[model samples]
Target: MEDAMQFAPSENPALATYSPEVRQQLFRFVLQLADTSLILGHRLSEWCGHGPILEQDLAMANIALDLLGETRSLYQYAAELEGQGRTEDDLAYLRSATEYRNPLLVEQPNGDFADTVVRQFLFDNFHYHFLKQLVNNADERLAAIAEKSLKEATYHLKWSSEWVIRLGDGTEESHRRVEKSIAELWRFSGELTIPTALEKELQTIGLIPEYADIQASMTAHAERVMEEASLVIPQQVFMLTGGKDGRHTEHLGYILTELQYMQRTYPGMTW
Candidate 1:
């Protein structure tokens, strides 16, 4: 299975036929996917030894690992598509906060446990459907990466869904906390499926799925989960933008400070 999942150069013949403009757009699309996972994974990893319970600590850590692994694979493929000499580390660690294409939702600080869970649930709901559509991407290598990542994403969705239900339907305090978290985080969710110019280009070329289709699927899934959890979906408000275009919130700067510290200090030092 590991060997079968290995990306071969021949898998993406479409790249050879594409114009340079199309190739650059595809590269940006891939980075958007990778950056989201990388930032979210780093956020989750901050909970390593701080989960409310031992089981949760381990679970969060494992999920973080899964996300980071996905980021590595996606970034590696993105680098290859760029056909430059940029390594995955360069893509992952060298970029400034203003250059990251992750949705603002993922880069937001993980507040309380409820806040973290709600954030994960919101993103996981969208991620599951997004990957489902991506599995059929016109780019075979992208599809292959999505196919593998989808398995982990399935587990992630289930885990987050169960937690959201557990918290939302639990005691009065738990319910209130998750509800509050939902309201606070809901604004960021809109950016997840709002198509950017690069994303639109990929959609036009059939290399990526339509944002509207993914948004519909995500909305249905989220509605069902929120219903089961006895939670209400907040009405849409003014949505925040610019994360996809490299403008991020102030929080991302601190995240980058911590995340890139070692790489920046040591340059290329590897164990």
Candidate 2:
């Protein structure tokens, strides 16, 4: 695993024993997780009032809250690790689009019902497997957080998976729309498994899951679900990058404008 706190109070040694360099890397990795959740949560929240149905509308909103809950835990930990006075809100709202570490997929626009479903299905698949590995992290704090988040990820994946199958194999119009959504979103899917340079370093130190292992788990589940959905799988799609490196699509700017509106405008506005 990449970024494992292997030097536990028992296993190897305490994390404090690690070089300053490794601690810095761990901070970066945690930010990636936090930023990804924050952006995706905001994206899903957009469907809150626009959902095709009342029940599913609330379902999407609930899932958005789930992602935000995970984001809070991750950002709080990241802030502690960074030893900065920055709060979770600072990390979530104060960062610019160029500073965010979420993958490009999460920041993309939700075009329609099928578009939302495919985007979510792809992300939920990867998130479920990723959290499963994190649940075993030697850092009990992270592992506990991962365990709690896993329950949400489990339901998230199931819900998105069912939607994929429902729309993919349904009426002619529904099937066509879902297939189009899959095609549009498939290219960004590659980035979920492709690690950045920082991740490779973390993998070597056992601080995070191996990209190969995560990719294998992700692929197996995705193939099974897509097969059941009867959706055509895209092959040899050109992959896009840069989100993990803090480069993002323009869509993120618009998302941030709305997402940060209150905090950015009021500066330190609190509950």
Which candidate has the top score in TM-score? 1
Predict model 2's lDDT versus the native: 0.86
Candidate 1 per-residue lDDT over residues 75-186, each given as its tens digit: 8878887889998889989999988999999998889999999999988988899899989987888888888889999999999999999999999999999999998898
The number of the candidate with the highest lDDT is: 1
Candidate 1 wrongly placed segments (more than 4 Å): 1-6
Residue 207 displacement (Å), model 2: 0.4
Q: What is the overall TM-score of model 2 with all chains considered together?
A: 0.93
Model 1 residue 30 distance off true place after TM-score fit, in angstroms: 0.6
Q: What is the lDDT of every predicted structure here?
A: 0.88, 0.86
The TM-scores, one per candidate, come to 0.96, 0.93
The window of 10 residues in a row where model 2 has the poorest summed lDDT is 1-10
